[model samples]
Target: MNGSYNLSSGTHYGSIGTATCVTGYEIHGTANIMCDNNGYWNGSFPDCIPVDCGSAQTIENGNVSSTGATFGHTATYYCMPGFQLVGPNLLTCNASSEWEPYEPNCQGMYPYAIRK
Candidate 1:
């Protein structure tokens, strides 16, 4: 089966129609779309790709940080104590298809001993 379809940004739609199997060419839209033979969408089905965090921000000054991620994917940051993260440790794609400011994790005070 086929019908008029309108896909908005950051949205993915797929259908097998009335057919027993869905072909790659059956689905159509301005945005990326895919249909499996079983009539199912794949991982992150309609995930928005992420952009790289090329710039670096300074925190407490223990380790350097950079942003790097793709849509439908998450990025995590780790640093030593006393040195915190000034940016988001986790970012998710919003309905607008944009990522929120990186969450910053400020490092806690260092301990006297290496092992607690």
Candidate 2:
């Protein structure tokens, strides 16, 4: 388990147990298990999948790109020609399935002037 498990009745026979995922992960499969006469759990463990932050948003006169949006990933922002980035250029995917440091904005530096 990538996280922790809680057992009721102190692992005694006929006790119940549940699996919980830590931050940045979601549980998949059966989350509950029953204790057997051998004082062990009777069900398979669940999979803890990483949280997804979905796709990066696009801004006018700018482009947003990233290799992936899962936890611990980064999104890079680049302004188009004649525009300027108004904030941080990078946003990282956090444990809560959101992008941190906020998304930047693209401002019109010069309508016709080339950006260097």
Backbone clash count for every predicted candidate, in the order shown: 13, 0
Give a tens-digit lDDT track for model 2, residues 1-116.
57778875577888878889988888888888888998778998899888999998888889998979898889999999878999999998899899989989999885686879
Alpha carbon lDDT of residue 109, candidate 2?
81
Top lDDT prediction, candidate number = 2
Please estimate how well model 1 matches the true structure, expressed as its whole-model Cα lDDT. 0.42
Model 1: per-residue lDDT, tens digit, 1-116?
Answer: 32232333323345422212122112222333445556564432232223333333434544433343323344455667565566566664333334555556576665667765
Worst 10 residues of 2 by lDDT: 1-10
Compute the lDDT for candidate 2: 0.87
The TM-score that candidate 1 achieves is: 0.31
Cα RMSD (angstroms) for every candidate in the order listed: 12.7, 4.2
Clashing pairs in 2: none
